[model samples]
Target: MPYATSAAFAHDWPDTVRLVTVEGAPHTGAWNADAYAYAYAYAKELAAFLAQHT
Candidate 1:
């Protein structure tokens, strides 16, 4: 999990925030995963979040 300090954006702006945290994922891991498992893992959730929010 990321440290609380990493959530400055959400902390500063609680409203209108859509935070996504992937445990143990390296920087840019979501977009750069070899098998794209990280990206795929959250694809549906992200899509749903976007659909509801947007």
Candidate 2:
């Protein structure tokens, strides 16, 4: 169960990475293409920031 309705990328992963997956359909955690686009944008932003910071 995640915070749906509001876009939030929450997951406990074992990597220096973040994955955002949007919900699709019912009773499932399917991936929406649009959400992936957003996630890609977010990842780019983060990467840029880290690159600048480090």
Among all candidates shown, the one with the greatest TM-score: 1
1-54 per-residue lDDT for model 1 (tens digits): 444654776778877565666666564564554446666757876898889879
C-alpha TM-score for every candidate: 0.47, 0.38
Residue pair clashes in candidate 1: none
lDDT by residue (1-54, candidate 2, tens digit) is: 534432333234324435444444332333344656656766886888699679
- The number of the candidate with the highest lDDT is 1
lDDT of each: 0.65, 0.51
